[model samples]
Target: MPASTEQAVRVAVLADSDTRWKWGALTARRLVAAEPTGFVLRGRATPTARQLAETGVSTTPPREVTGAEFLREVRDAALRGEGYDVVVLALVGGTVRAVLQGLSELALERRPVIVTGYVGVVYEKLADGLLLRHGADVVLANSRHDAERFRAVYEGVGADASAVVEAALPFLGGAPYTPEAGRDTLVFAAQPSVPATRAERVYLLRRLIGHARQHPGREVLLKLRSKPGEHTTHLEELPYQRLVRDLAAPPNFRLVYGHMGEVLDRTDLLVTVSSTAALEALHRRVPTAVLTDLGVREVLGNHHFVGSGLLTSFERLDAGVRPEPDAEWLDRQGVAAGGDAYASAFDAARERVADLLAGPALPPVSPYYTADTAPGYLPGILARHRLDVDAPEARPGGLRRLVREAARGAYRHGVQRVAPAIRRLGEL
Candidate 1:
């Protein structure tokens, strides 16, 4: 396809440490910029600043900025006017509040801001979506249920969701559903995610192992959210090594990580304790089971899925009963961002943005922002990141990245051969 030379809609996403949120923003960017040169992209913030670098996904590093600087820069720039076509902010919480704070005093009416928020997981309207529906030009919701909720709370009316766009989540593989040649692989998407304790993590692992043992022919893949040890606010209380030693691990079962799109290509069955990843699998038409043996609402958060007709226990697994997904549950969950649904949703959002930019002049949100309507002070967006008014420096990618890649490969090889020996010595 030829690159578009039209008036490019420069989309800038206020990125932070959250990878999932970053992907959500990226999805919006990609969707809005259907044309090639119609997009100028930048991701601001550390932690996940270079999220897409060196991966199969994208090579461009998000322009880095401090959380503080991001808020200030976005505010000052928006005040000056005409730097970006649209600025994407976190939908649930993040820069939206601070950006709104900056815009509160200014009487700018034509400023374009889009909030990208996902809806697969359940969350309350604690901060009223950080006033996204009210302030932002549009709020992107991944599900119809979420779109309705975003509308109901912000506009204070149940008439319909207010200025909400029901677009298919972009990060989801968006691939067609094709049954595997044979059912040989079962993936357990592990997300001990903040709420789970050390003991609960071990229990989930044990369940996975027991299931793996039951089906000797199948290779059970334990797909982790993060690597064995990595820094994240959403901590998994326990390390896999400490728990693996106690169990009789099956030879076929092992830890694996890669592009989820590629992993799902080979997976026959997926098991999880409430994960957006499981929803991704179900969207792909893969046979998925939500484990509910522990009955710990805080840990797995799989309660909502119980009525989906996809929940199963060890007893049921042992009895050879496979649960099928109920259509109502699947529809409500917003499964499959592919086919005609995705195309229609994407087109709708694009049309809305086009209309907003090209239509009549709009009035400013407010000249004096009220505290009662406001959420709270922005933490990570302002104080942490060393944001500046200027654009982030362009990263050197050609020779430099190649050299770094070579060195990293050799270091990784050395660690793979020596890590086990080091682990054994540490055990003593």
Candidate 2:
């Protein structure tokens, strides 16, 4: 509904992952879709400030930048005055800290960054989460429960209460109804973080093998987020190949990765260690069970699916356990039975974004540690942002990181050199 003559509002959504990108895209498009008010909005479509701001009336796509580039590759971009009225942080880990610092360095009215990635199984306790929650101008919460959690934490820490905006967690709400004609594939949407260690991973695989054996004809695929040596949450990089070799390479078991929709279409039963992927399976009405054998709160966020059937013991799998989807818990997570709420959330978010665009610019909010506490985090992120003086790992793309990278490279080179020798020794 933008006016034919008025300028469009440009928002740069910085994301490197699937979920962040979706939310960023949705939010950006929604903001652009807003009807024009009397105010003349401009600079919304410009990629970088060095380039001229466009006055055209069109929905500008959110500039999707990788987290690494936003954080480590900031100076050149910021120096060029290549910034946005809003920079959405859809990243986690050191990248979040680094990007915030880079934005602060630009000193261009401290552009408002809408902090995102607030959802179930709160990573809010982590360093990156803490920094993002405190640092962002607007913190988005997927559910009222999550919003309350954010509010409680902010209140306890005496931070800005106005930043939190509870909204429906963005989802692929319009998945085509997949009919189960003859599909019987059982999929484990595996996580590198779950199963904790190498030994635990082996145990889980062994359990899967045992369960697969029970259903003689069923094919089981372990879906991994990334291949070996890829970036993930786990410490060790154990490949399914290694596990298969160790387990004599079972025929029915294999590692697979592709579109979730494709997998769900062919899947008879979907299982996981409390992955958000569970929501997808449940949406398809695919028989789903949240693996809770570990029951560790930090690792297994399975509690969020309390009403959904828990697959704690493989013995239950052997005994023929079926998924009992919890309509209430699912509704609360904005996954099931609450389709209306989810839709409404999108409308509200658009309204909110429009309001955010119109509101007078406020002082820059702290994007690190504790916002309420001044002189936050010894050798605080502010120094790194303004001075570009890094505080070790706390700062992104710095001297220590370069040194660590060199060391890691040398170590990896040594491993590659030694690997062939080790294989020969095993043969001998």
Candidate 3:
């Protein structure tokens, strides 16, 4: 049977929740509901998929295909006698590279309108996905800065860039709770994987304990992602545990495991080293601080928070330093600007997809092309995939080599710098 335009859109979700799959599920639901033609979600054992299914959304088990096999499936599905007008690939990390490579190969035969939802900084991995040079018709960003970052990284490589306010899991509607008066408690939410850097961990611990001491009357809660495993006790190994124990008795300081939302709701001020929780706190209008000396200041700064002077140095805290709130910036970040922004973004995405389907076929580029044409060819390549990098690439070098080096650099830097910050912050 011939597939008709009126048939429900078959949207295959490539999801792994530890990454951006959770966000992908949320976006899928909204997209399916908005259009009369529903969508199908695919994932390998995702809680979000189950939730969607419970809500009566259609879902398919993620085929247990290796990265290469997955792309082959996408190619065949798009080109098979059956007409599948659009294929949305929701990917993060290395998976995106594989999908793009496959798309490029398939582009040699027939052009399929492919839309991709990337959860992290694509520029950081641009080299891995040479096919991205084909251009993504629409690129989504977790934040405006991320969108700008994408543009800065991919310009000239191919594809125009635009921002799609990342669709978030529907865990909380609007602000989850109103700020309570007389709430003087501070919560440090930590993820698992205790920090391995002795110096950094010690510094973070001292700052946290010092903050507790400064607000003597307030309760200090340490929330852990999971209960300490066999090798460690959440509190004992902590660098500042001894100091915290010496300064304040057990009752003043509490160690909590699990039930993050419950803890977040009651938190008066959220202190994070580099946890995304800071962003969540911001969305909730909860006063939050990111310990700067830990090397995550750039990320926090991009969010437009005024410098808090709250470094890892306890001496600074003892001096009664506090972060100054940028009222206007906070207001801009907190404003929900009605549903108009989201609606407009969705409309734009749909239009891009429709245009791709209706447009002239795109030409294929040789995989063996030299580095010189890499950036110039990228815009067209990415266009086929429906992603947009809003800014131009930063490096003056050839796009291919630049992307490759950038990806390697991001991997190394993220592990050496960002990962430690995340670990330390999560431990808090």
How far out, in Å, is residue 194 in model 3?
Answer: 10
RMSD of each: 7.1, 8.5, 11.4
**lDDT per residue (tens digit) for residues 136-195 in model 2:** 666676767677777777777666667677776555454544656655688988875665
Q: Residue 321's C-alpha lDDT in candidate 2?
A: 75
Stretches of candidate 2 off by over 4 Å are 1-5, 16-83, 93-98, 123-128, 174-179, 233-236, 307-312, 367-428
TM-score of 2: 0.73
Q: Write down the lDDT of every candidate, Cα atoms only.
A: 0.57, 0.56, 0.46
TM-score of each: 0.75, 0.73, 0.58
**Candidate 3 per-residue lDDT over residues 171-196, each given as its tens digit:** 22334447677777778755332343
Question: Where's the lowest-lDDT run of ten residues in candidate 2?
Answer: 37-46
If ranked by lDDT, best first, what sequence of candidates would result?
A: 1, 2, 3
lDDT of 2 at 401: 53
**Clash count for each candidate, listed in order shown:** 10, 4, 37
Superposition error at 67 for model 2 (Å): 7.8
